[model samples]
Structures are given as structure tokens and as C-alpha cells.
Target: MKERGQQVDQNSESFTFLGKGTDFKGVVSFGGTIRIDGRVEGEIHTTGTLIVGEHAMIQGIVSVGVLMNSGKIHGTITAVEKIQILKPGVLVGDIRTPVIAIEEGSRFHGMCDMGAHLGSGERALSLDMAPGLVATAQ
Candidate 1:
């Protein structure tokens, strides 16, 4: 059987959506890599990479393995592997992820706890709450 979360063939046709002119509302979930070039107004969950193109706009939660943004987002994000915000990217919400890379021109306006780098890769659900990915101390 194929391993869970294995990368899709780089040579195969990938999934993509152009949202620059369309308005989307509701949750979005997918397995393979995806690129959004429009607007989304709901939660998004995916096992593979999720790319928010430069002209894209997102206004909800995002949970995925790898997230890269060159657009504008107004919600929380939980990324298991990594998060990257390229130049001109704008984010206005909390973030919980293992690895994060932000370009000099990017703007972020919210709380960030980089504790995931400690290896647990778990972000505390709340300041007084246990991280969702780990067992709590008894």
C-alpha cells in the first residue's frame, strides 16, 4: 500500500483553482497539492501542499501539511511541516506550525508561538490549553 502522506508524482498533472475573479464560500478539503489563485471564505484542510497565489485572498482557517502564501489571509493556520509567506503576503491571524519562513516585505498581525521547533510540532490550542497534537501532562 502507498504510504500515507506520500508526495504526489511531481510529473503528474496537479490540481489547481483560479479564484482571482470568483467568490468561494464553504470548507475545502483535498488530498494532493493545490494552488489557489482566487478567493476563499471558509476552512481549508489538505494533506499536501496548499499554495495561495499572489493575487489570491483567503478569509478562514487553514490546516495542512505545507502552506505557502503570496496573497492575503485573515484567519488561523495550522501547518504540520512548514509555512512560508513570500514578499507582499499579508496575514492577520494566529499561526501554529513547525517551520515558518517569512519574506521581508510580508506583514503579519497576530500571535505566534514557535514552540513547534522543539520537535513536538504541536501548537497549544490556547494559552492554558494543551496542544492538540500531544498528550497532556497528568
Candidate 2:
């Protein structure tokens, strides 16, 4: 398992980096991995991994295959595989993922849905509806 994790990390190393001191606001769509160490306010969609480095700040809707956050984010996040919030990270948004891990000292303030049924094409419908309506549908 550790070896597999290492391999994944190695594969993700070839990524585009949004270095610190930068600020962006718009839609960002990409493949492979991306590491952000700056400020972003917009939508982020990717079919690969997203790494929010320490000191980063993001406010948007994030859709990705994997999310590893060590910064601050205020928005909704949907991960196809997993989401990990490292120590000192802050996430103030709703989360929808198959798996999630929040380390000690991490701060999270929002709803998290790790329902096993998320992949059956039903989750999108629920997400589009109002919160009250979603509850009634469930």
C-alpha cells in the first residue's frame, strides 16, 4: 500500500504549479496533477489529482479525481476517489467523496456525504436539488 502511494506521488510530481504570491479568479480545467500555493477564486475541474499546498487559499467548486489539501478552501468539493485534509488545513465547504481523511489539527465546517451510492448517477440529481428537496428524496 505504501509503495502504491509512493508511485502515485511520483506520477503526480509532473504537475503544473500555481506558485505562491499569485492570485487567480476564473475557471481552471486541467488533467494530471496541479499544485496550488497561492490564492484562487473560481471553479476547478480536473480528471486527476489536486494538491493545495500550505499557505494556499481557494474559494470555488472543485471537482477532481483526488484532493490533497493542506491549505484553506471555502467552497464545495467533489472527489471521485478521495479527499485528504492535512494538519492545519481548513475546509469550510460541503464535501462529496468516496473516501475522506482529516488529520489532527485540521478544521472543517460543512456537510460531508460519503454515501456508497454516489457513483450510481443518482448523486448528481441530489446535488442539483435544494437541500430540503434532497432530504425528502432520500
Candidate 3:
């Protein structure tokens, strides 16, 4: 559940990036937890939590378990479980997830949906914010 303001359980895993000192350019796939401290320019697939640092930048697609962003993301994001946009976070693309947390001070200019719960396979996140597109967020 989300309040008028965005909030997530702190008990959830946390990841941080220092930013301004790292750069990445390729496809990324991992499990456990991921935190972007610099920059990424490719497709990202993970089975753990993903955090985009305040100054980090991402320019590609992302598919993960959970996502919390405090930076800039310019691509599509497919999260299987949940997503949170921290203050000052900027996201400019489509989002496919079951749960979304949008903070008061964040910037998100895109469509989103929540229709991935009706399938027989691994439950995917739905992007009801759009039409005619189905994605797997989990």
C-alpha cells in the first residue's frame, strides 16, 4: 500500500551508488541486488533489487525484481514486483509493474500498466498505463 506520499519498507534491501565516477555500456544480467552508481547504456535484467543512484544515469531497458530510482532513467522499465521513485528521480519511459511508488518530488513522464497478474507463467507486471503491450516484470 502507498500513502499520499511514496514510501517503501526500509526492511527491504537497500542499494546505493556514489555516482559521477562510474560508467557502463552493455547488457547486464544479475541476481541478488544491484545498485547503479555511475551510468548504464544497455539492457538490464536482474532477479534482485535495483537502485539507481541520485547522479547515476541509465539509457536502456531494465527488467528487475524491485526498483528504486533516485537518478535519471531514459528507457523502459519492467519490474516484477514493485517500484519506487525517490525524490528528484527522473524517469522518461514506459513502466510495467504491479506496484509503483511515485514520490512527490520525482519526475516521471511516461505510461504505466498493471496487467501482468493474469498469466499462467511467472506473474509479470502489467502496464495498464498503455495499451496492447504485455511485459514480464518479475
Q: Each model's TM-score? A: 0.74, 0.76, 0.72
User: What is each predicted model's overall lDDT from 0 to 1?
Assistant: 0.80, 0.86, 0.79
TM-score of predicted structure 1: 0.74
Q: What is the C-alpha RMSD of each candidate to the true structure, in Å?
A: 10.2, 9.2, 11.2
Worst 10 residues of 3 by lDDT: 1-10
Score residue 43 of candidate 3 by CA lDDT: 94
For residue 46, give model 3's deviation from the true position in Å.
0.3
Clashes of each: 3, 0, 11
* Residue 57 lDDT (model 1): 92
CA lDDT, candidate 1, residue 138: 35
* Candidate 1 per-residue lDDT over residues 1-138, each given as its tens digit: 111222345668456565557667888888778778778889999878899899989999999999999999999998988989988899889999868899999988898766766756655566356454355443
The residue ranges of model 1 lying beyond 4 angstroms of the native Cα positions read: 1-10, 117-138
Ranking by lDDT: 2, 1, 3
Q: 45-92, model 2: which lDDT tens digit per residue?
A: 998899999999999999999999999999999999999999889999
The reply for model 3, stretches above 4 Å from the true place, is 1-19, 119-138
For candidate 3, lDDT tens digit of each residue in 3-113? 111233445643333246666677877656767767788898887888888887899999999999999999999999998999999999999997899999999999997
